[model samples]
Target: MKLYTHPDCEKHEMPGHPERPDRLRAVMQRLSESGMLDDINVELAEEISDETLAMVHPPDYIEAIKAAEPEEGLINVDPDTYMNNGSTRAAKLAAGACLQAVQDVLCGEEKRVFCATRPPGHHAELASAMGFCLFNNIAMAADYALRDERINRVAIVDFDVHHCNGTVDIFKERPEVMVCSSFQDNYYPNRYLDYTNEHMINLPMAPGSKGGEWRKRVEREWLGKLEDYKPDLLLISAGFDAHKDDPLAQIEFDESDYEWITQQLLNIAEKHCAARLISTMEGGYDLNALADCAEQHVRALI
Candidate 1:
């Protein structure tokens, strides 16, 4: 697996926020200390174009965010989202990292890629910004895969503790994209993924559910639909916030659970496609657990 990250990723932040710079720094440092970072290729991602981001987000919304980048201090865009001077570059670079990862996989340069940048982007809606996300990186990456690369079917599996309301909203009406999200029900950004098109699958787990419960739903729902869709590529909104130690959610998931799910997705990818997978950072608040668990998740990609 190839890796893409940027220093600007740390530049976007809010004081005492959960989505802080240390999240990326922790993961990167752990991967390095684990020796996994040395075993793979690394690339510094560039900025994605406005048009590429606009593929999923509206133009006015894009301009609003770009225009919101403050010259001095932090600007609160929403209850959860904030922008410092470096936010615009950070968000663009995050999206660009996913773009490069997808292109790399489709071009056969790598079997898979993990995008390790911030701020997490699952809760961001198409025309709205919330949940510490400025843009829909994974959704835009999927759109980039479909429109520019001509990939027919792509399955986005969001394993975050929160529902990917943004991704679902973007692809709810389009059959070409299939989105399966496992989130904590009755939580912030409550489940709203609904459409008769049969393109979106939103599974909200109970607050106290553990890995055992998660496995059942994925086995019964996600794997079956993914196999049926026969996606040309697999993209993961890989959020480790479901870990037991995360403060944002109450679900209990260990690193073994993350490894298990990654293997399951890899199996489907190997069976249907050429083992091409692109995953981006979404959520994982606990520094220690997030770092350790993310290390295990990336190990599966290798």
Candidate 2:
């Protein structure tokens, strides 16, 4: 497995932000302390090209985000998301990390890759930016995997606290891409699970649902979708915010739950997609839970 990250991810953080530097710090520290950090090849992600980003996001929106960078004070794009001086580089590296993971996995250099970077994607849309995301990194990776690698039928399985509304919107009509999400319903940006596309399988869990309930949805809904789709590649929007310890969301899940879900996904990927998997970091607020759950997710890759 390949590990993609950048120190710049730590730089773009807003002070006292839920998606702060300590989140990455705790995750990296846990991997190192658990004697797992040295087991994989660590690659500093390169900058993604403009053309690559434009495949998923509009050029004007990209330029607007770049222009929104503040050299001095925070520029609040919304009540929850803002930009500091470091946001541009951090966003670049975040998108680049997923892009690199896709390239490496498709080239046979690595069968699976984990992008441990920040400013999480999933909430980001084609022409809008919100939810602390400046760019939809995994969305760009999906486009790259389909277009550049010439691989058809890709799928994104998201288990975030909130739904991947942006991903569903982008690929709703595109049969080649399947989107499965297990997120809290009636949460921010409201719910858009009404899309007519059967490929977009959304299992909306109520707030405060436990890991067992979440896992059952994965087994029943997502796994069935995975079996039927038989995707050429499996992409995971790996978010750990639903952990009981997470400050931002209400759900009960531990590291073992993360391990179980990853193993399940990996099993399907192994059977159908040549084990070509790219997992990208999304939301996880509580540092300890995020770090621990992320390590568990990584253990399956190892």
Candidate 3:
């Protein structure tokens, strides 16, 4: 497995915020402590080009975001999202890491990849940012893969505690890409509840639900959908916030849940896509919980 990340992500964080840089720090520290970091191939993230970002975000919106970056204090992009001096670059690099992961896996450079990036992108929309996100990294990566003539289909599975409203919004009308997201029903950015699309699988887990509920739902819903889709590559919007120890959400999943889901995904990927899989970071607030869950997930990946 190949790991893509950057320390610059820590430069763009909000002070005392749940989505602070320490989240990635904890993840890396734990991976190192567990001896997983040294065993894997670690690469520095590259900044995505404007053309690549424009594939998901509008040109004007991109320009506006670049202009919105503050030199000194923090700037609020939404009710819960903020930007510091390094936010724009961090967001771009996060998305870039996903894009590079896709290309690397598809070209056989690596069969499996884990992107430990920040400012989780699942909530960022085509023209706006929200839920502590800027650019939709997984969405853009999926878009980039679909743009390649050699790749016909891709599957994106999001196990974040919150719904990946941005991803759903981007590909709701597109049938070539299959998007399956399992999130807490009563959580943030509650739009698209009424959406009904053949290619989109939205599983809303009730708050306080445990791993058994999640596992059952994935086997019943996601597995069937993935079997039918038969994607050329698998992408994951991995969020450890569902762990029982998380402070931002009510879901009660633990590290074991992360390992279980990863194993299931790996099985599917190996069967259909030559084991090509890329898992990207999304949400997870509790430092200890995030580190532990990330370690288990990476252990499963390797």
Query: What's the TM-score of every candidate structure?
Result: 0.97, 0.97, 0.98
C-alpha RMSD by candidate, in order? 1.3, 1.2, 0.9
Assess candidate 1 and give its TM-score to the true structure. 0.97
Q: Is candidate 2 or candidate 3 better by TM-score?
A: 3
lDDT digits (tens) for residues 121-156 of candidate 3: 999988989999999999999999988887788899
Query: Model 1: how far is 113 from its true place, Å?
Result: 0.4
- Residue 183 in model 3: shift from native, Å? 0.9
Off by over 4 Å in 2: 148-150
Rate residue 26 of model 2 by lDDT.
88
Clashing pairs in 3: none
Looking at model 2, report the run of 10 residues with the lowest lDDT sum.
Answer: 188-197
Q: What would the per-residue lDDT of candidate 1 be over residues 1-302, giving only the tens digit for each residue?
A: 79999988999978898999999999999999999988889899899999888778889999999998999999899987899999999999998999999889888899889999998787788898888988889988888888755589989999999889888877888888899999888887864833324668877898889999899989997888899999988999999999999999999988899999999999988987789899899999999999978988999989
Global lDDT of each candidate: 0.89, 0.85, 0.91
Clashing residue pairs found in predicted model 2: none
TM-score for predicted model 3 compared with the true structure? 0.98
